[model samples]
Target: MPATADFKFTASIDDSLSGSSCWSAPSNIALVKYWGKKENQIPANPSISFTLNQCKTITGIDFQPKKNTGQFSFDFLFEGQPKESFHPKIESFFQRIFPYCPYLSHFHFSIDSQNTFPHSSGIASSASGMAALSVNLMDLERQSNPSMSEEYFWQKASFLARLGSGSACRSLKGQVVVWGEHATIQGSTDLYGVEFPDEIHSNFNHYQDTILLVDKGEKQVSSTVGHDLMHNHPYATRRFEQAHDNLKAMQNVLTTGDLEQFIQLTESEALTLHAMMMTSMPYFILMKPNTLEIINKIWSFRRETKIPLCFTLDAGANVHVLYPENDKAAVLQFIQSELVGYCQKEQYICDEIGNGALKIQR
Candidate 1:
């Protein structure tokens, strides 16, 4: 039996909920490169993302649909927009995806979304967006599979969410998440997001990351395009190895509390990781002037003030400063007054390493 709603979208529901349950998933920054996925968007190997402290998305779902094919009908309220976009991509997803995932097709969604940070600041909003969507979508799943565990639901959701955005799979959980090694380069890879163990969570508490709004310009070589470059890259294997090694080393440092080692490995890995993209035949340069400037400043900080600020980049110009949380105060001031300089005031997103991703209300 399906329940239909005319107020939002009319569709079928086995049972009607009192209302809607809310969930929020925090945004994350890749301390290491999670680039280059295989077909179906699986990654070459496992990589991780840190659920950020600052950025996140909240979504609420009251699942009653306007139609009865048991299809995926969604009405989205994107952040701050006067009206819901009902973005074309989403509509198309319902039209196409419902056939395979029949349950989705029947229900229509009344989705409300808001971003804690700027939409396109290279902060990986898609990660949180899809995460929130999937988690919130679970309400529909739960209606039927009341016995299904939350973990199981999230695993399944991550798998589906990846088809929407690559980085999104990681946003299904908090603290730390990995798309695993099964993914292709563009994040198009199909891999379930896994939460880290409590020990790993405890170990990462002191880690620091600062998002630098470099040049604050457009993102070149969007993650998807970057993956395409990776597919055709001659040194793809080497780059993959580099990313894997970096991830392993990062995990070790977090586990062992090795700050110095973490800094050294992180900077080298970021350069080499992006270099693989730079040298690609089709050249994808996502780094803005401030990206390089911040890099140089970090280096100079090491030489002049003797700071231990290491840097990492994802698919965009925004640079993340990875350092020790204890040193965070000085880290923020140093970047604001010294490294960032007054010149680049136009582009500055000073924030520390944030917590892992989680649903908003849930």
Candidate 2:
């Protein structure tokens, strides 16, 4: 309810408690991008996103009591192999959240995580990965505090996930999610995301997002670096204002099934994301030539076919081709015949609207 952690209660550590948790969380594509941020991982402007089905991360943690120490410890793995490189990030995340979950200090953790799509290929692995991890952490908490209500459980997970990655909070739900503080949306706050209240129109619900992996390689600039650049960006204020206004319009579009306005706002947000990057002080461009080609082709295809299909980009060169489910036959055909050539190794992930994170019983 508050914008930050209320810390209303804490779990008393039980030495006999030794359990594990696993969660599968779907990646999300932002229709309204949250670019800049403030301290505590709060977004500068509210954004909306669509949770995707195919691109996901499954993370499980095995925990047991540590002997004679209250220090945080974890062995992180990626795809079943030990990954020392991922340790620092996870360690950092643990440190940020350790205060709220002091029980973490009493256990050693073995984390196993894997992704269905390429990890850093602009598919939002952080959103899925961090959300999965956050849910698992809360699941662990529920073991000691079984009386916790379901609403508080998810709110805590979304809160913790945001501390790890700002957008990760949005990955906690399905169809559509909104993160960051907003003036119009009720219950919307900067601490965690809230799902859209209005019933999403069928046309927008179950929409398709065919990821065109123009470049599978990592970006020259990480999203962290990109966000920091906004601190001194000349257009930061204007961009933030635009995002707020766009989010308002987007709400109406989703509720009323205004596909034309949807396409316009989505594509504009995508291009604006890159435009910010290109205009940064130490300017850098993330969109490759093939990214441009795909964009142009998508525009031409839409013009020629009059389909409601449109494209959006993350911080990388990859393109997410979004359209209504009814248009999938034509859209997929267009991708197979025209857009596949631009992808690295013709690699693309077919994804659609999805329900948020799932807890694995095992």
Candidate 3:
């Protein structure tokens, strides 16, 4: 098969993409949309995410023939502890995609990854881990089969990452990643997300995302359960349509470079996502009193200071503040005060919009 867009490097996977030296990939923050997924956990729509400068994961994978069953003999160590879920999840990921790389049955993979920042602190650490694993495995496959396209290799790697965590798929692409409607996303048999169309992606990278860890505590609605709630909700379609509309509006503004329109639409989308969570028939909510208070404070502060600041949140209560480059310092100060007043066990974190997956070679 011919190489896909990203996989094609104008040359075969020779000494460059080969070898098991130390490898790493960066964290990502979402810009557009990626609220749903299908089979291999691909996104329902083409969403974009920025690779971050601050947080990253360094991983080293060494493949070996084990003395065990077809299942990989796994050893995982990161953050100075053994990640208990790593082994089982990796096995499960292999079980689901056995057709693509049946050799997984014979090889044992020793993997280690650690973040430059706190783990599971609403910093999108999964994004970095997933992207790193995807690229590392793909590079391995390329060492064996030099004819693969970068796109196909990434897609396959993404499929595997999805089995570990859904958001990991977004981490496979660098600078900005677009998780589109492939089988995993569009309810088909194939895995990994489809890339966005050229027409839609042409102007996508200009928009930026800056995250603020408002609460930094744990999350109430994890991505997996949160997605399930969306499915079970009686007004699912209505909310989905609302998200769709919001995504479209945001995309239009992104293409036009309209900052005002972008902020308004993104703020609305963040609220709408939470609103959907609130109104689910049985009723579930991810926000706490502090969450709401922080939001209100942000709005109040913006109103009082007349600053061009706007805040948005992902699955967790941590708020991501979005503003132009000129206002970054002021926004950071605002977040610091809000944390001092509202949150009990939270730290103020700020990161500008980042790029997609990257291979940090040894």
Each model's lDDT: 0.65, 0.88, 0.61
Candidate 1 vs candidate 3: the TM-score winner is: 1
Count: clashes, candidate 2: 0
lDDT of 3 by residue, 221-274 (tens): 677776766666777666556555655565456556676676687677677767
Q: Give model 3's TM-score versus the native structure.
A: 0.81
State the lDDT of candidate 2 residue by residue for 36-148, as single tens digits: 89998989889999988878899999999888555778899899999998888898998898878888888888999999887666665888889999999998888888998
Candidate 1 residue lDDT tens string, 4-66: 111122244454443466777777766666677776556776777776766778877776645
Candidate 2: deviation at residue 39, Å?
Answer: 1.0
Indicate whether candidate 2 or candidate 3 has the larger lDDT.
2
Best by lDDT: 2
Residue 14 lDDT in candidate 2: 90
**Model 2 misses residue 25 by how many Å?**
0.8
